[model samples]
Target: MDDATRIELEAATFRRLVAHLRERTDVQNIDLMNLAGFCRNCLSKWYRAAAEERGLGLDDATAREIIYGMPYAEWKDRYQREASAEQQAAFVEAIRKPDA
Candidate 1:
């Protein structure tokens, strides 16, 4: 594919992923981090980084809002749950894995 087409496709895929995540509020970030090595926050950071690379001045809050479909604080207040001990241990182990 051409550069523009590839960019468009990537943007579309990102939007779909954000929409899916917004719909699945039951899936906690800690659980995602444990299983996938990244979560919404990581996506937000990557979004910010990509903006910077493109000379766009996007802040973390704006990037997170894009990913979370609202202000991250609001999402946390409504949907975030405290990680269980098992989840915490799994997260730590996942992080410690060299492949992760």
Candidate 2:
């Protein structure tokens, strides 16, 4: 595929992933971190950084709003849950694993 086509496909995939995450309200950020070592917050931060790299003045809240499909605080209030001990332990262990 041409570079432009590849970029378009990647962008579309990213949008789909974000949309899926937005719909998966039962999935918490901590759970994502424990399983994948990243979450919506990480994606938001990446979005913010990308914006800043392109000279846009995107802030964290707005970035998170894009990823979450709503304001972060509101989403947290509505769906965020306290991480369980097991989840926290797994997250720690996951973080400690050396990348191969």
Indicate which candidate wins on lDDT.
2
How many residue pairs clash per model? 0, 0
Query: lDDT tens string, model 1, 3-100?
Result: 99999999899889989999999999998898888899999999999999999999999999999999999999999999999999998888788971
lDDT of each: 0.94, 0.95
TM-score of 1: 0.93
- lDDT tens digits, residue span 1-100, model 2: 9999999999999999999999999999999988888999999999999999999999999999999999998999999999999988999899899985
